[model samples]
Target: MLGASFLKQKKALEWLSALFLFLLLREWLLPLPSLSDTGSISSFLYLVAGIILVDMTFRSHWLGLLIKIIGTLVIFHAAFVEISLFNPEWILQTLQAVSEDFSRIVNQEWTNMSIISRNLLFSGMILVLVSLLNYLVLEQRQGLWFVFITISYLAVLDTFMPFNGSGAIMRTLMIGFMLITTLHLSAIQKGFIYRGTQSAIWKTLVVPLMIVSLAIGVGYASPKAEPNWPDPIGFLQGKSVTGQSEAIRRVGYDTNDKTLGGPFQQDDTKVFTITTNDKYYLRGDAKDVYTGKGWIKSDKQLESIVHPKNYIWNDTLFSGLETKKVMAVVQAEGEQLPAIFYPGQLKGIEELNPENTTLTYDTISQGILTFNGAMQKDSNSRLFVERDDSTLIPTPVQQYMDHYQLQAEIPVISEKKIIAAGSNYPKDIEERYLQLPNSLPDRIKQLAEKITEGSNNPYDKARAIENYLRSPGRYRYETKDVPIPKEEQDFVDQFLFETMRGYCDHFSTSMVVMLRSIDIPARWVKGFAPGQEISRDANNNMTIEVRNRDAHSWVEVYFPGSGWIPFEATASFTSPLQVNYDRLANEANEFNIPASTEEKEANKPKQLDQMEEADKPVVKTSAGFSWGWLWGIGILIAVGVWILWKKRQEMYLWWLQRKMTQYAQDDFPRRFTLVLTIFEKMISPRYSGETLREYVNRLQISGDERQDLLYLTTIYEKMLYGLKEMEGKTRSLWQQTIERLLRQMKP
Candidate 1:
């Protein structure tokens, strides 16, 4: 009975030791979060301690199983929390929102909270929850299976879900848990016999040595921060509270107090400064579609060619009014120069020059001119272009009609012959013309109906809507706060009825929808608002700079003889948007101060003056090694040294043990003493100098024959010298020898 009890106790101790070894392997191999962050290290250590206590307990069989189950659950819970797989959708959405909010916050836009703090808070909460779950469910052993199932479900979700930062973290944790579990199981099967003998040496020397080496390496690799770091703020830091005003003023635009600084400042200077020799219209944008809300470009099938002859030009026959010509040098400051230089009528364009230019005229009403050159190049230089805006002759219209086939394809007008005037418009266009949103405000519709009560024709109704919008009673450009109801479908309805204050998008959308309600063909047109004038360079050229704030959208209305006409229906400015030519020239002269100084010093002629300076060579410096690199290198070196030292020590010990096994006699007592001496040397301070005789005398055996005593000692010696291959066989022999010795030997 006593032997059976001892064997059972030994087996339990072996199992407990095996469990701890498995845990140690897991921690070493996997990239789990540090013990500090997770409290996992303490939990695991406590679990090992608990196993030891259970082994000593009177009822260790059940108690040991309970402790192991609890410990395993705790470990699982910690891993789960670290990965953060719970409520994945909410987590992803929250992270996305935080990223967007961080962008806004960096730009000085409104954000509810700091993104970093939010992320940290969320991570901490998850960590705490995981800890709690481990403590409650895992410790109690009541929900171990449930916990496993939950983890499995989360793992599946993580695989199927879209890639995200949180999902990545969760996957890492799940993989870690699986690896740890596998390693732990393997270690448990290996048993704890070897580990029990080796633990003291590893704990005292091996682990501490590794930890100290790593610490030293880290200390050597870290870099010190500079005592006086240079100020890193850029040009914007020097400007006033309204830095946008300074930016605008630098571009030769007058800033107003109401403009509001930062990115929203509106420059009052004209984008283009035109010096014309003749009285001709400088057209900018063309508005073709006539929504009840506003005028926008018409949606006509884009033709290969966009010229005046393709559409109605004027109401008269061929006349000499076409001779009204103008040669203008127009300098633009902001926005790209449109190929259609103006919105009104034009006859011809000549002598057009741009540094980087591409012209595309697919729409009959307009052309796009994209300047590929830099805006800073044409500060004050004059670009000469001739335009002829004259009354079109009826003969030209008749000639155009004779040249191309015409059908009354214009929407909402009846069919008629091609003519300059009195042509019947298509009636079918009227039915589909007015298409308003179903959720448009009743008040807005009522207001629109009231404004165009007497209008019969589509043109008249469009005019009424345009006039009503342009009038003082409608709207302004000031920012207004309006909380949109959750139930609202269309943004236009909310703006027109509730807010009544918005930029071009709101106004244009509202206008188009309203016009559709009243059987008018209208569409939205997006383009750049006029830019401010900047200094010009030599060769008679000027620059136009367009910023993001200049984006504008409006509406267009089509007319019978004139084609699409533009109308400003949203918010009218006090002054016409134009670039100040004189101011731009003055700024250019001011900018030329340095060049003028050099020219005067060199006695060079003013006519020979160069506009741009040559580029200078920049000094280059390579970035030195970073702290992270140094630390990595240090760690590698430390690990290398440790491995080398461990290898050398292992080799020395192996050579010594081999020599002892070969030379030492197979005398059981002597061999046992040699093994004990080696173990004492390996363990150092903890090991006492206990000889075989002393140890045997201390155990107080009742009776032991010389043979039994020799046999037990021999088995022990064989195990120590690694002569015995199987621990179980050696242990069984030791036990039988011990029993006989105990029966025969006296104290």
Candidate 2:
């Protein structure tokens, strides 16, 4: 009965096949958002398919074509423009923008195109794809190739990216099998219609459907064991430094840094906001041990600290340093982290909420982990607190420290002081910071020594390494497309010698490792850069909003007298930590600490005209003189040529008629003669001895051309041979006849 009903509808099986193909196509789009910035792709694709199906269903071809055009325009409007589709003014504006961007694409200025233009192009491609799918399913009655390509695409994404394609694969398999079955049945139906026969295709489909269902059920229900062989892809890609495989993860600060180096998308989710007078990097933690691939902590001992009584910076040993007190307040706005965040050289905590919050500071990492209430310490220095005590049971650490205030003593040592303080060994610092893997390549050390060849002191050596890594064209600041180092490759070695492009981790790690190779005590520090300033309060304090995108890492070089100094080694990034170069410029003549070239240029006083020019906004100019006029002239010429090519036949005919009319005003005889010459040119010149009447009859021309020439010959003979002077009305009739004859000739 079901098979009979499908055959009765005539179009049911075809539509069913198309619907199944649509579902299969949809699976290919499911994982797009995770891999790119495109969002709501499924909705856009659905809109396209729905409109295309509507277009295919219309009875009138012209009407359906018109509907398809309008529907495509509507989809473009919805996808790229944030306005109502019915607004004619905005639609025109959007189309103009698209046209301008189209020219940019023609010029191959791909990077300059805005995101809107790119998405517009994507929408156009989708429109074409759906239209093609229409033919493949309804006309060609085949979609097996499309299904195979989609499965391959999804399988690769699943293997390489964080996308899970198991469910998509199952759905695709089911839809593909059904779609093929329906197309076959529809083909059988078409044959029956052609042969004037009748058959129920649904009856043939029932057996395949039952078999597919049983197979799917058994495959889904069957107990499966783990693969006998390990993942071949993992072996091919090789293990990370942590001896484990890693997939690309989202960009943010996480507790784990055991495995590093891969692509990550920017996350703009705000984590915290800081209000302070001066910009400072929000330090999270530090890692001392380098495993050639990533950083790890060698020490985990936590020291307890209570606010107002104990200062975190008191343990540091330093001398001959200029410093000032700075203060900041951090407010947690997003998901709270498990640790407390502070700036450099934390003096002490002035305020913490709930009055029962406990802070444990890791001596090596300098990272502060928070917990509830007064807690006792185990032999390992881990915090232990009574859970049952009503007073001790405090609010969540994040909630308790949701908002806090602290003061930091920022060091501002000049280059002269740093250089004068020679290398004085701190045994623990040297042991921890100078440690490198035995397996590290020797070229890294050689490169370090080569970079710092002329430098005499540790400070100069460190600066040399930092400058070399960040020099223009030597390295690039890329967030994504950074590959994880293979098992045999050291992360820093590969970056410095092989890839030469990556994010902060690549540059910072290379610098730290290089510095270590030359015996400069350096450690890897991870934190947030001084974030973008959102606003300033009435008191002149700046409020900076820090997001996950602001997460960064840098090299911290320790000097004997000046303590640890932060240096930025990432390309296109500047260190926020300020150094007062002029403070000791004249204090020590022997040391002669010349300021960096950048600082010298920055310190130079500007003249009145120079200052005025600097105050003005800079305008971007093209290379050399503008040739905009030349481009305009070229475009005009191109337009004219195109018009001539498209309408050459009509223009030629009009020109010939205009010339005939001009000659007719003065002499109708000359006009008639010109018509005869034109007709001769169109076919062939009269034979040497042939007269006009003979030429017209023997021309071998047929249809309207032959008839027009024969008629005109009679008129010309009457005027020339019969000597019958034409009246005014007869002359007009003669001219009309000539014009008709000319129209019959091909341009």
Candidate 3:
């Protein structure tokens, strides 16, 4: 009743609603901890406060003031008298409990806010914040400063408590909109923002409509890459680029979370967008340690941090000779903070932003890219790499020379299974992927053998098991009602026998354990799924939007020459059943791996130098001038110019964002001013005779395209002329829309 009545206090209602919107974003997006943890506690307190505030509002001024004073005194007296609010503890004990939760968080042992010592600490903070918000927004109308103050606090807080893509993006947008609301309300109160404009009412509607459109574009237009989560440990350790290779970092992501007993909770917030030459499963972090409870990231391997240029240019040093390259353009969804993800073995990574964020390579995982800090909003990166799935069926083997893999046929009389069986993995792979806890059940082994009864080789056995579980109607794909196994029952055992219900992690983890039981080495890998392909380019490049729900886990089985082969065991996401596997074994090709190597290389362009050398004809002339040469050079230059024109806006925006992230002050508002000034001078180039929108009008663009440009110009005017702050999400949209316009139209 109290929580419900708090809304009756008009002032409390406004700020409290805003706070709820911010808090509930977790439930909407990637809520790390369940809502029942602290969220519910805080909510309950809100209701109680609502009743009190509402009742007090109806009282006379003196009575209301006296009641508030009495309430305060009572609370203090109770604290002094050692009275417990929720538990048998005094105020000091509650404080100690909150302190313990913080310590657990710092240790990275606590699973977010789920099992905190006490809820009163956060509940109390929320109550105080809402009270202050009400006074500022309703009574004093001093909401703008408070809004900025909160945002600044969150940014610093985020370094300590990093948000997922959804959490971060939602936080930015909600706060931004609320800030705009407060600004307009305050302006109206002071005769500014909301004081009727001379433009048509429809003209005023343009910016809002533009925001809606840009929001949609940001959702679909960005490129999806591997998720780079926030690093709390890294943040605390040092701001330097150097760090160890922890498969799991402090990135607001913990796959080892114990979700065995409860329903699966998914967050569908947009993470990143991806555009690629060909669609394939993206490679992400890998976990080798299974502690019976959950996967733990151990083995802190280290490699020297390398710059983007060094990684790309010296490919032979990292990936070896004659490797296939899959080019991808990826966009991370965040404000100025971003993360990185990729598919297969990455040869190079090019960030659109200029932060010069160096990537650390996991010499162990080979393909994984690790960034030191969060990336900027609309930050795009290009990946030159190779995926593991190959058409050449790996030479199945149980025995091979230590140098690499060599084929041999093994015959077993038990089931008269005779097949080639000598595909060998690196020694390190065998040790890591084959490691299984003693608690793993025999049921998993029996099931693996039963599933692959007739299969005579590792590839065949692995494929048989994978295909069986992936077949529809056999195991349904779901995240809810997953049974929490008893203390003695293994997680895999429960899913395979009792529940028979699970999601990607369950399926993948089960598959890995089962394979290991049968002497087939496998490990678990995770990243966001390749989302809906929205558009395809002239070169058949695809654009996809990957969200939080798309985050997935799968199996990677190691094979020499083939690398770590990605296998999909999830029921709903299996690829084609039967494609000719041995067809891609090319004794003639330069690059290794079988399946998609030829497919990937066929579409890739030959080097210009090589092409020229191949096509060169003997032109006997005293002078070096030839009409053919002139024509070829002209064509190359035109193509280069065309490419540059198409990507110019993205290039500019990335450059601007990169600059903002690297600022010594990193004061967002100040950096925004500098960036906006530079954008106008360099990109739009405001002239002496033309108004901002007039300059755009001179382009003679009309209809939808003109509306988009006009919207940007309108926003620019408001931001330049009006005393409003640029919302983080809005800034991301502005950059995206401009880039979209540049790509769509010739201008």
Provide the clashing-pair count of each candidate structure. Answer: 58, 0, 33
lDDT of 1: 0.36
Best-first order by lDDT: 2, 3, 1
In the order shown, the candidates' Cα RMSDs to the true structure are: 28.7, 23.5, 29.4
Top model number, TM-score: 2
Write one digit per residue (lDDT tens) for candidate 2, span 550-635. 78888888888667888877654545554544422242211111122223334332110000000000100101111122233335
Estimate, for each residue in 503-594, the C-alpha lDDT of model 1 and write its tens digit: 44555566666676655555555544433224345543333343333435556544444344333345432111111112112212211111
TM-score of 2: 0.46
Q: What lDDT is reached at residue 469 by model 3?
A: 69
Top candidate when judged by lDDT against the true structure: 2
* TM-score to native of every candidate shown: 0.29, 0.46, 0.39
- Whose TM-score is higher: candidate 1's or candidate 3's? 3
Stretches > 4 Å off in candidate 3: 1-261, 312-324, 335-339, 352-354, 366-423, 576-580, 583-747
Better of 2 and 3 by lDDT: 2
For model 2, the superposed segments whose C-alpha errors exceed 4 Å read 1-247, 306-319, 389-400, 582-747
Whole-model lDDT per candidate: 0.36, 0.64, 0.47
